[model samples]
Target: MITKSIKGIGKAVGVMLLIIFGVQHVEAQQFFSYSQYMNNLTPLNSAYSLIDKNGTLNALLRKQWTGIEGSPSTFIFNGNLPIESINGAAGLIVMNDQFAVEHLTEINGFFAKGIQLGNNQFLGVSLNAGIRRYVANYSSLDAVDPQFRNDVRENKPNIGFGILYYSDHYYVGVSLPELSIRDLGNASTQRADFFRNHFNFAGAYLFGKEGDDVRAKPAVLATYTKGVPFIADMSTTLYFKSILGIGVNYRTNNEMSGIISISSDIIKLGYSYQFGTSATNLGGRLSNATHEVTLSYRFGQNTMSRSIL
Candidate 1:
């Protein structure tokens, strides 16, 4: 009986150690990315508006590792409008992200223009301007510590650009959605090694005729940031009669996601659930499941298949 009690106590100590180290790693991660990224590409590349020429409004909410205090939570809004005469599109993106003692908000507006390269082929470029505000309530952690006496706060200007080559069936793009000349500030939390620029590259292809009962889309996105390993996401979605979608995604970090959506001509709703596949996974104990929901409205175009996105 004593041996069993000791074993149980040992496990408890191991778990506490895991939580301490794990939470710090979570704080280091940038949680802006989402599981339903394909539903709204504006955050990654505003130029995607070039191919999808519809007046669009989309909102998304995501909660990561449910039940964990200070886990990441995000809210995003984006709207895009098309200008047929200029072969261009304009859009706005706003996001709020909070985790641990840090909170960040960004607002950006962008314009993209596409030039015809050949039959049904086009190349597009985009430019965006924005402000990023970061505030960390370090003082809340320990009011008695001198280092935590002052909270960190900074507002910085940002500019970014994206380029894409697209047609009716497939598209590929690369973008730096947030570029800033000034740093967040001189805090240990703002380690330059981890606070560098982010790069995004993605591509997608659709298969099947417009009238087909079933269609498939395959997509891949790769992201790189300093002091982090390259992360890649690969997904395949199947759409039925352009009304219902079911998909699965795999991330390089051994994370798996399941997605589903229901759509009409004017509105669409989507949800995704994500979890790690590892035995000692964040989804199991360090945190919990990740949940994301997306809602979108589009007008002026239902002529194009949803796969085009």
Candidate 2:
């Protein structure tokens, strides 16, 4: 009887694993971006749109788990413009994330209103609306299980809001991407279930005088979901002559990274490399390397000539 019970438990565990893997495999592709912590600047909070001094454009590309087959890759493009006359800003973001054999494409528009505070501090409130397309390919799983035959496509609409407070030397923000909504798709067969809420907080501090040619900037970002421990990212950047930048970052339970950035009067370029740690080391060197790049351009008039916080 004990042997039979053990066999039953093993079968149950196997079935559970199959279900979890199948569901996660599809959902994983929808949000497969390593630099999500940075991308959250827009999707997580509307107030972040007002953080920039001038009209700016930015792009990001990420590749994770280098040697692993069908690991994850992502690309994003976004632009923001501050309407100084009304203390408001407008922006748009587009992203494509791929993991395993699944993919997610999203486009969102954002708006933010900035309110002046005492002593040069400011607060901003932001809102965002967007659509996400989720696609999955189950052909790869056919060899493992012939019963897995549901390869489908889905699209969903979502809205998010955020608040931010900042000054020349420091900044902090909070945001929720999905609010409390659930089941955003209209398909008869449920393709995916998005989290009801994703909470984020970030802050940055600057060291050194404003006119100094070099300065140290330290920043931290934290994220949380229901029933999960908080994940934090700590990073620091050394800026030289207001144009060149070098930085390093560490993500809890994940990886360590090095970064380089350049900003001019018209454009900015950034690149980052992440090396996996802990259990990730078992995946081989190539599998540990993750890469990211960002590009930004300015438009319209140049009112504020510096970038900080």
Candidate 3:
């Protein structure tokens, strides 16, 4: 019964983990899920940089299970420079994810270019190259135990690509953001499959006319990785004159979140809170709430203020 309870707890945590965790021998690495993905999608799709005509820098932090020691946390810093000359954009993206005694950090640089396919339709493609480092200090958990005596550390090169078709009001795209070329550590190719090749499919539509005081946008993002079920996020946000935003997201795992933001022409601040349904409750053993915050700065000439997506 104790083992069953532990398994239940692990499954509950997995629903929102987004990133990977490692036991002594199992290699599990996945992508991070942020409630405010609609704002900064560069982490998911490099091509998203093309949406903004201006130079933008964004910083985001996500803290899960607040108050718990060594709980999951993530930080991302992203910058984009739009090149109208070639209808392309260049950017840098850096992300760090930590949980328990495990840490993963990746730094990447990307280039994206677009072309006009029709009168108003455009298509874009992007490529990213980076390095990923993973460290697991198992001995910290239980030094005396043989299983936890040794630590695991691995470094691997990372490559990713994205394609997007977009216009003014709506867009759709697909991307493979983490493609691992080789296995890591002692884990064989099959065991290491969990760490590589994550695909993201996303799209969004905007509602309301141009210059409208109020507008609404709905977005859908789905992710697929080996050894896990398809994960999806559905969200709808209401924008008030491009100054304030309020939205909610529901994941296929039954996790839900509420988001709010306030912004100006040069700066923006956003927040999100996530919780689980009663079906996945932990009976107060752990905090069921997660908090995320984001700050962004935009400069250069504004072609359309900000992207609706």
Candidate 4:
């Protein structure tokens, strides 16, 4: 009877571990979106808010792990406008990320000042302020295990800041999007909590002649966080006649991606597809790849008009 009881307890413990691991995996915080290469403007850093030459409004939607249950999805909307009179710019960014029963929403504002570097290059410094909210659903877990009967839903607030330095062709930035600490409720007379710190570096190079009808642009982005290892993305895109673009990307430990962009005088459309690597097959289950799309609009002085003037 003692041996039987021990085996029963071991089985229960195993089940609980599996349940917790599965749920946390779905909610784990991984960087979201593919176009982060396009100037690292995800609101995690305030410096990118002023990088654009003209007023830019962009939106990105990402669907990760397509067929998997409770896969992650993210949406981002951001806009930036330079204030020539003040020699700086102000911008806004908003994002929502969802995984399984967990969700996070963030909103931020950014300000930047530009310094002329001669030779048509300029340096910039930026500041950002943001708010975030995290929400979890405990009811969903109660249905799967009776041990979760006492689980309660919870919400928390987060605040963060960042700084960035950039030129026309390259940028490097660091940000802590969840720098503030908050209590996680009472448990044994002490509150348990965790803060998020994100560090980022990015750069791009333009080649193949400035006046050529076709050009090649290469870019790289790297990021690190307190609890996660470094992640890098390298990509090169061929611009055709200054209106269309095609590229390929390799993300460390993630996926190989193909991307395309089409632009008119005022609007641009972009899309990317990520193919799962062998690491995903290790689980004996075919993982769904990621799909992303972006739309952007540039208002005010057109590129053609600037050239002519």
- Quick one: best TM-score, which candidate? 1
For model 3, state the Cα shift of residue 288 in Å.
2.9
Candidate 3 backbone collisions, by pair: none
What lDDT score belongs to each candidate, Candidate 1 first?
Answer: 0.79, 0.68, 0.79, 0.62
Better of 1 and 3 by TM-score: 1
Residues 1-309 of candidate 3 have per-residue lDDT tens digits of 677656545544553242332231122214677888887788999898998899999999998777755677899999999999999999999999877767788899999999999987899999999998877776665555586677877888999999999898888999998888876764333235436688999899889976689999999889888766677889999999878899999877667889999988788899999876544333123576689999999999884476666
Scored by lDDT, model 3 comes in at 0.79
Across 1-309, the per-residue lDDT of candidate 2 in tens digits comes to 677656645544544443444343323222333443442366456687786768877778887656555666788887888888888999887878775656778788888898999887999888888887777665444423444456757777878888889877878988775553456543325333333356778887878877689989888878776544456788898989878888888877456788888877777788888875655342233355778887777776663466655
lDDT-better candidate, 1 vs 2? 1
Candidate 1 TM-score versus the reference: 0.88
169 Cα displacement, candidate 3 (Å) = 0.5
**In model 3, how many backbone clashes occur?**
0
Give Cα distance to truth, residue 276, candidate 2, Å.
1.4
Please give the lDDT score at residue 262 for candidate 3. Answer: 94
Cα RMSD for predicted model 4: 6.5
- TM-score ranking from best to worst? 1, 3, 2, 4
Where does the lowest 10-residue lDDT sum fall in candidate 4? 186-195
Q: What residue runs in model 3 are displaced by over 4 Å at the alpha carbon?
A: 1-30, 187-194, 281-285
Q: In order, how many clashes per candidate?
A: 0, 2, 0, 0
The RMSD of every model to the true structure, in order and in angstroms, is 6.0, 7.2, 6.0, 6.5
Q: Model 3 — which ten-residue stretch has the worst lDDT? A: 20-29
Tens digits of per-residue lDDT for model 4, 1-309: 677656655555644554454333332334454543553354556556556556778888887767655566899888888787766778888888865555667777777777776665666676666666666553354444455434333445555555555554455566655555555542212111223455666666766654569877787777676556567778888888767888898777546788898877677888988765544331224454678888887786533421100
Deviating ranges (above 4 Å) for candidate 4 = 1-29, 33-36, 39-42, 143-146, 149-167, 172-178, 181-195, 281-284, 302-309
lDDT of 1 by residue, 1-309 (tens): 677656645544543454475654453344478877776777888898877677889999998878766667899999989998999999899999876677888899999999999999999999999988778776665545475568877777889899999888889999998886775665335534224577999899989878789989899988888767678889999999878999999887778899999988778999999888775567765655899999998888543545436
Ranking according to lDDT, highest score first = 1, 3, 2, 4
